[model samples]
Target chain A: MRTLKFLLQKEFKQIFRSKSIIFSIVFAPIIQLILMPLAANYEVKNIYVAFVDHDHSSYSQKLINRVYSSIYFKAAPYSASYDDAMHLIEQNKADIIVEIPQGFEDNLVRESHDKLYLAVNAINGTKAGVGSGYLGSIIRDFNQDIQLQWKQPGHFAEAQTIDVVTNNWYNPYMSYFLFMVPGLMVSLLTGIGAFSASLNIVREKEIGTIEQINVTPIRKYHFLLGKLIPYWCLGMIVFTIGMLVSRLIYGIVPVGSIPLLYGFLAVYLLTLLGAGLLISTYSDTQQQAVSVAFFFVLIFNFISGIFTPIDSMPEWAKVLAYISPISHFAQVMRMVVLKGSGWSDVLPHLGAVFALGVVLNTWAVLNYRKTT
Target chain B: MAAITLDNIVKTYGEKDQKVLAVDQASFAVEEGEMFGLIGPDGAGKTTIFRILTTLLLPDSGTASVAGYDTAADYTQIRNCVGYMPGRFSLYQDLTVEENLKFFATIFNTTIEENYHLIKDIYVQIEPFKDRRAGKLSGGMKQKLALCCALIHKPTVLFLDEPTTGVDVVSRVEFWDMLKRLKAQGITILVSTPYMDEAVLCDRIALIQSGKILSVDTPANTVKKYPTKLYAAKASDMHQLLKDIRSYPGVASCFTFGESLHFTFRQDDAQNIAGLKATLDSGNYLDLVINEIQPNIEDYFIQISEPVHA
Candidate 1:
């Protein structure tokens, strides 16, 4: 135990001596938290609307005015033909095209029905998908307005109609950044901590200092503890700073218990740091360790429900996602912080994370060798 | 009792056909508190034997022990009793000298003050620079700090592999002097070096080459094992002189050492200096000079390492 203390002292001195690591630990999350949510947003806005309105009627003009006045779209040059509007889309001048057929205001007036065509450029898939949905909702709202205008005096008694409204329960405003900042913050903390911890051990190998340590009387567990505990503490500190940034800068204070958030973060770092140690034990050079760690961290991020909703994933991939510690931690972070979930809500996730810690940490300890 | 022992130890690396015999069926022992040296050139497997005894590597076959503990079974006990300074100066570079020393001391469950007497002579030189980072220290100081850290635990046996290989000659002398003092304090020292001159400093030395032991004895006895009378001969045209000397007959070995060629005679060759010189004279060797000289450990090392002699 005393030997481990000395080893930790040595490790911490080295970690603190490096200015680059210090900046990364203190500021990388701060930077990422402020930038990532703004960049990763999927909400489509300010879509360029190009239209070929052949109806030349008051109704067509009113529909065009409604499209321009909505919050989600902007009016671009009117194209005389569908091909010209497509050309505008190809030139990146427009995002969606509205086509009203030559009806002379006859179909909706006489038959109470009309057809409209929409062409959306889908080069950027996510942008295209969300933009089309906005256009669809805008047309639906316009149709309801026209129906209310027509239902004025003695026409029809209370027609059967169903009204639907989307409340977006967790994020009432549908703010993407508020929904994403907590998860991104979690990823950033784990990323920097795991990377620095593994690189530290492999750096010692490259410098040949490990040979001196290997010849000593120190036990393997003692050495591993000495190497991992410092980074674990560093991860928690970084996580705390990230939380402060989310709350202060983005106005994203968690509704759940902050202590519960930290409680799971402490256990999550065990799994992360343990995996990092395993990488260090297997790698002979710092470069190899970094590349391997980068690969695993990327994979963990992709499957962790940080960016995509895990419910939408395929069945097999969902199973694989649940197996990742990041998935469990990210879920708990969202649950506790965003949802104000209690102990009962996160108990299962916490148990799984602890189990991953035990398994990965035990594997790391067993793989470590004082002698080959 | 021997502080360390290796009985017919063998170590190999790689596959069967391309296998390298790093230490091949070699055996030797170092007496308690004796300053033992494994002397050879680069790639001579000096480091391999040190690694085996340090318990950092296991021999492919045969048995070895340190402090009466088996390297295989009692490795933990051996680790507790031994201190190893590997060939490279493998101390933490970013750490201050004092911190490096203190860390190693603590790991061994002791303090530097406990064994200050053993390393006081060496550590005091670098005391003023204790706050300096080890990587920024000079080669000599780096060696001293490494030595101080290795000895902080006061182990029963100390294994130093090429501790002075890259050190300056003056500092190399000081390091060996420190080793002598450590021996006096009853700490058995096993040091290996590629530098042949360092061999004579050991109380007993093993001359090894290409994964095999050539000779094991006191430095004087190893020198005595040189088979024939040797001569130091040089002339104005040394290049031409070598060709003429080799052809003039009774040369068992002729190796260049500084300005002269060390000439040794074959077992059956007559050791008549006048006759040897008369032949060289007839061969038009200019300003030829030949005289008998005592053989040193380097001469014995070369003699034994030569395939013809082995």
Candidate 2:
């Protein structure tokens, strides 16, 4: 409609006239993408290992050497007593303490087994958990090495062992960037798109311009369309920038159909912008709209399975996770980009986002009133 | 048919436990091509009546119509045929003057060229600064630009709510002159103002107070209907003069207007005036002067709305 053209023109002019909005729109996603993955890494490293060796046996020294040689840990200054090692941990200078009992070599040779103790600083739960697991695996491997050297070849054949191999299917190298870039893109795009769109109409309300428009002959749908179209275009631009950054900076390129990824992004943006407009209708000021949008966006990010696997959440939380469009979009992004999934693979996610878009847009239109 | 009509319209705000009446049993009509004014001070329901007729609000009871369209049922039709300028400057401030005008014209399904003659007089005054953003404009310039945007559509009826509330005196006079020119084109104009002096400029005026229409007539007629004689009295100590006259038995209402107190009598006769003068002269009132004066729209507005007269 002719009216829509004017509305769109006016909306774009206002959007661009405010220089601060333009600056943030073009760069916020870039900055977030560049910094988030490096900061949100789950692979824990740089653990400080402190040792308390009472026996001072050759085997104990060998085990200590093996633990420090691994890339996951660094060696701390040696402690003469368990209490001294514990003091190191308490001072935050060491992450994990390894203590060997007295007569550890004699015990292992004659009794065929020995006891070792490990104390980990549990303040940062993830670091403590992962660091202790690495140390335990290293000690187990060292025990096998010593047993093979001491035992006879005939006895070694008598003991049978089960070998387990794992093949990382999607990410062969298990690069965290590859896993995080696509998911972070979903959250970043949703944030920029929803926040700007939510503030649009409410800004007009605060400035008193909405009352002038309400008195005109402009249809409600035309007005909303005018708003949604410009923001949708901006959302696409931000999405493209994110994609280029992921591919260039993180070395991540989608394996599936590029058009299919964009197709889902288009629908996902519609759903988010619809919710944004709904917030605008309920708020009387820009500050109120921003706060309400922030509350919803924060919850969506947490439940979207970007940082944690949805499968690991409790049953109630899992149910709530699936209800959010972000979870579906993040899943589709990972599936299509990482797994090379085709149309049938992502069809369900696309359908869910579309259904949500319809409900949100309908509610927004109904809530908007020309008169009270 | 009246160009605009409100029949016993009543509107209230807030919840059931605490209701504040904004408009109550108020009714008036404006004729075609006539300039009408709803004159009142702040919180006097002038803006509420404008909102009701503009289809921006619905009266809790009774019916109102604009350009022969019912406000409740035919709201969409009414919206299309009416141009409204709210009390606040509601145009897009971030937009340039030309862009704001063009936008309003486009949304109304008409081009600025189509109604160029209607807003030409007012728009020309603001044309030189069309490239400037509206927010940066002076108060008078902003008012002129708002008028142009509201008139771009050239609706059958125009509702302007307190258009000159914050404008300077010179610009206020200029705005009234522009409105007079629009009347020659046979456009029905309904404007409201808190400035009592602006009432006499309208062809017919309705004086409202406390959600009620105190009087609806021509400016001259409303003043002529003053029930009793009014006099202006001033002294060296104007404050004492007001207190002394208010306490007098013959005084119905007395309020300070400018340098003097406008005193109206409960019983107006030659004897009452003479007695009041003698009493004031006997007191410590210095250089006291009293003279009978003709009542204006403000005087009538105060007299009718006064609780003693009610």
Candidate with the greatest lDDT versus the true structure:
2
lDDT per residue (tens digit) for residues A310-357 in model 2: 999989888878888999999999998899899998999889899999
* Model 1 Cα lDDT, one tens digit per residue, B1-310: 8999999999998898999989988999999989999988888898888888988888999999899999999998888889888888899888899999998898889998998987899999999999999999999899899888888988899999999987998999998888998999999999999888888899999888888988899998889887888889989889887876777666777888889999777753455566678777877765888888999998888777777454
- lDDT by residue (tens digit), candidate 1, A50-108: 98989999999988888888888898788999999999988899999989999936887
Among residues 3 or more apart in sequence or in different chains, the pairs in candidate 2 whose N, CA or C atoms overlap within 3 Å are: none
In model 2, which regions exceed 4 Å deviation? A158-160, B308-310
lDDT of 1 at B133: 94
Poorly placed runs, candidate 1 (over 4 Å)? A151-160, B15-17, B247-250, B267-285, B308-310
Pick out the ten consecutive residues of candidate 2 chain B with the lowest summed lDDT: B301-310
Deviation from truth (RMSD, Å), model 2:
1.4
Native-referenced DockQ of model 1: 0.82
Model 2 lDDT tens row, B60-119 = 999998999999999899888888989899898899999999999988888999999999
